[model samples]
Target: MDTTVAADHAKLAEELPLDQIDVSDPALYQQDVWRPYFRRLRRDAPVHYCAESPVGPFWSITKHKDIVDVEVNHRVFSSSSTLGGIVLRDRPADLELPMFIAMDPPKHEAQRKVVQPIVSPENLDNLKDLIRGRIRTTLDSLPIGETFDWVDRVSIELTAQMLATLFDFPFEDRRKLSFWSDASTALPYAGTIVESEEQREEIFRECLGYFMTLWNERVNAEPRPDLISMLAHGEATRTMSPREFLGNILLLIVGGNDTTRNSMSGGVLFLSQNPEEFAKLRARPELVDSMVPEIIRYQTPIAYMRRTALEDAEIGGKTIRKSEKVAMWYISGNRDEDAIEEPDRFLIDRPRPRQHLSFGFGIHRCVGKHLAEMQLKLLWEDILRRGWTIEVLGEPKRVFSSFIHGFTEMRVRISEPR
Candidate 1:
């Protein structure tokens, strides 16, 4: 670290006390040492403030109940794009893609309803066979005795395939969905995924152009069950502007891919780290139903969501000013003991597994929550049925982003343990 930057961090930590804690640093997450930092905040300052950081000044809502309070009270804690959108960082002005998750009430509902049916329970049931088949083929292809990147072979591939199916995109080029999701959320300066903001925008334009061709086709043809067709024909979304259309498409693609992909990889890593939990799961494969939420809870993809205050409000003894950015740290809250029993443990068959805040709460909760859960449930059920086992071989390389809580690489072997 630069001397000035290090000195500055120290100065802030001293002067601001616990208020100076900035959990948004990507390095904190990448190193997998963020637990202690959040523990400090939850114990001393559940609604603490950091006057400055890479993303800028913001409040960290660390405890579970406090985060849910921010999520439910939408009127006071606005998620409007006009304020700042959902991430801890502000969306680029020149490239603001106004998706509904960032908007409030009626507009959010109207736009969301347009494409919501694609992942409805009935549709999910219809798609189960296909998802299971794909998962089986991908797992069966792995070499049993040799190590391979579980992320590339299984995690990314399954999620990307599902996303391609959702968008009805060409299956051969499906990895492009994962590529686009990474480029869209990653910062160029972060040195993690994309190199620069201009390059990132260029990739996004290509994504939009590809989708536009599909949009033109869908509008001219008969209605279909695919997402593009639904958006092209739905009364609420058919007349959307190019920016709005791009926003919605990006939202669906990223929302549909990243969470499940990481959670799949996270599940293996967590189990390997907690062998007793794995024993419990393996002993009773039927526990797959309960295991799904525990995996999501332990992984906690998309760590923190940001909301801008519409008015002054008091939370945890601190007063938040209007227009201030307040982050609901779902990752921290999921591990908050006040909201869960032994929040740090990785038990697979906990009685109240879903009690954690992974899918979030209230209106803005993840739209694909059910689908993501189903994917994990089915993945585990298939793994157990085949009597297959995986051994984590080495330290996992985590995604270098505070927002996308996931793995970039994890070496694993599919053979039986010695």
Candidate 2:
């Protein structure tokens, strides 16, 4: 081997421990133990490889610039159906349901256009009042001076309702949709994977079966405002088979549900830790608009997204071979020294908050980005306006998955209504 190849092997050996980096613990996720490791990778091995069980080894892309390059140049580094899924590890055959998030362009663009308008700014503007009302009702229902699970009460409730409204699904069963989405993204150590997978398929069938019934009823019916109605009646740019429709619906639910849930939980945690910042927002509620993005930056709910190389390519002076998997650590990228000033600290009024990659970058970026922001802003505004005091009663529990980093349980005490 050449001298350069020897050095690359040495570097890879040194960074082999990244394969053991477990994100299942809340403390590890909160304190961010991976930041230092990512910083080293960004400095020495921007395109380092690691070997692991189940799925073997894959390259780790830590630098913000490199991540953007791979994300933007989807032609070379594609999200195709044949190259496995978009996740770091290969999913079980039973649970392998492909969505647009894992598809390359032409097809991806065709499917994306179907639901894009429903989540656009104009449509979101129409939803502001309804969202605000839901927020108000959620806060009002919280028991005063008693500890309760904030994750379930606040985050899940809000996002679940938003999703239910988006799909025109029965409001009462919205939580079931959230449950299935959460299960579909289970991590290696999240022991509930097997059970969750079984349950997910059942829930999906139930939900999709109902939607199909609705589709039949609405096939010849007038165009309704909900996403399902639009998708059912829209031009057939890409035909959505029953399986594909269920997969995409499940994708939207998981995408819209978990990230926003984590952001809401993270927002409350930030407020509890930074009382001064909370007070600043309470004093001037208009700041909630900008504060939403700051919370996303600070918490980075969706920690990382994995992509596979379709062909051999060079990034940040390193060559990635074809069929190699690459994990984009968004949590570390958001706090990249080159990306933002005082990246560690939570600053509500930070200028250029949208610069954060929390919603990701390029064509594969989140379609519900605007909707998530509106929900966060409205929730914060509602909490402040209602004169609520959110006290952290205990330590927050983190999810076991690296893909969707969020709270499983957050005990909190809400003060009485003033």
Candidate 3:
């Protein structure tokens, strides 16, 4: 362990609420319990190390500028297939999928291009009506003055339906797709359910089987404008082998599922917590455009992403050696006071809110960012127009994973539309 990491850890143990700092527990992430500790880290040790983990010791890169530098310079800090995927912790071989998000340049660029057109701004605009309809239907389904799990009814449903439309999959079974995606991504944190390699392989095989069925059906059917068909019949350079295709499917499922779902739940929670901001949106719904980025900044659905140092590099005045894992704490960076004024307050009209690190930075920045924003904006618009006061009925439950930070269950009551 680096001397800095040792010293920082010792300080953290003494000054911080070390016992409550369990990154694996979703509840901790939801209540924003890590904020104070991260604030301490930012002030004390910007580039620190965690000398222990399920995946062994790793460095925690918690500053805004430092994370941007690592994200932009992909050559120095690679998201390669060999050095384990973007998550700080490594998974068992059987559960690993060769997704582009986990790949470095050339290959990552090639694979990314396959689905890039589908998520482009123009394509997203084209889907606006379809998206609005989905949101309206979802909001309508919630009976007036009823309490329900917001995570299940709103967040999961909206994203799943949008994903179903995007992939040209059967909308009726879209929830199953969300389930598989969650299971796949959460396998690393699954204690008894996915106890061993065999269990993990079984779950993945089941997911792959369903995807294979969809792939074969789409490959034979008439080409539609959906992502699957686009990849099926797009330019030669965009074509992918079955393995790569499966990898991309898994990537889409995981990427599309958690981030937006968490953001939806987080957005609602943020509004409920910050009633003033909610009232601001209620007044000027047009701010939904700017509000989307602010919500992302406040929620920060994905807590951190990992990168392996390909060579010796200096970040934030700290030396990182070759092959060392550097965890970019997006949660911490988004709240860096130097980057945004009044970083702790949730301001809907925060100018240049997109500058936050929620969606990441540079080349590997989230490709589905536009789509995520679109969905969030549409959902908020629908909620506001319905004139429903969202009340938190119970404490939200978060997913037990360090990789994807999100809510698993959040109960809320909606008042009758005025």
Q: lDDT of each model, Cα atoms only?
A: 0.87, 0.78, 0.79
Which of the two candidates, 2 or 3, achieves a greater TM-score against the reference?
3
lDDT of each residue in 1-418, candidate 1, tens digit only: 2456545544544454675578998986776767777877888788889898988999999999899889999999988887789887786787677888889998988888988899899999999999999988988888988999999999999999999999999999999999999888886775556887778778888998999999999999999999999999999899999888988999999899888999999999888888887788888888888888999999998898889999999988899999999999989999998989998888888899889777879998888999999999889888877766688986788878889898889999886545
Runs in model 3 lying further than 4 Å from the true structure: 1-27, 93-95, 187-195, 234-242
Q: How many backbone clashes does candidate 2 have?
A: 0
Residue-by-residue lDDT tens digits, candidate 3, 367-415: 9988898888888888888787898866688776666778888989888
Q: Would you list the clashing residue pairs of candidate 3?
A: none
Return whichever of 1 and 2 wins on TM-score.
Answer: 1
Report the number of the highest-lDDT candidate: 1
For the record, the alpha-carbon RMSD of candidate 1 to the native fold, in angstroms, is 3.6
TM-score of 2: 0.89
Clashing pairs in 1: none
lDDT of 1: 0.87
Q: After best superposition, candidate 3 residue 101: deviation in angstroms?
A: 1.0
What's the best-to-worst order under lDDT?
1, 3, 2
Tens-digit lDDT string for candidate 2 (27-86): 445433445556666666666777654456777777777788888998888776557667
Question: What TM-score goes with each of the models?
Answer: 0.94, 0.89, 0.90
Give lDDT: candidate 1, residue 149.
97
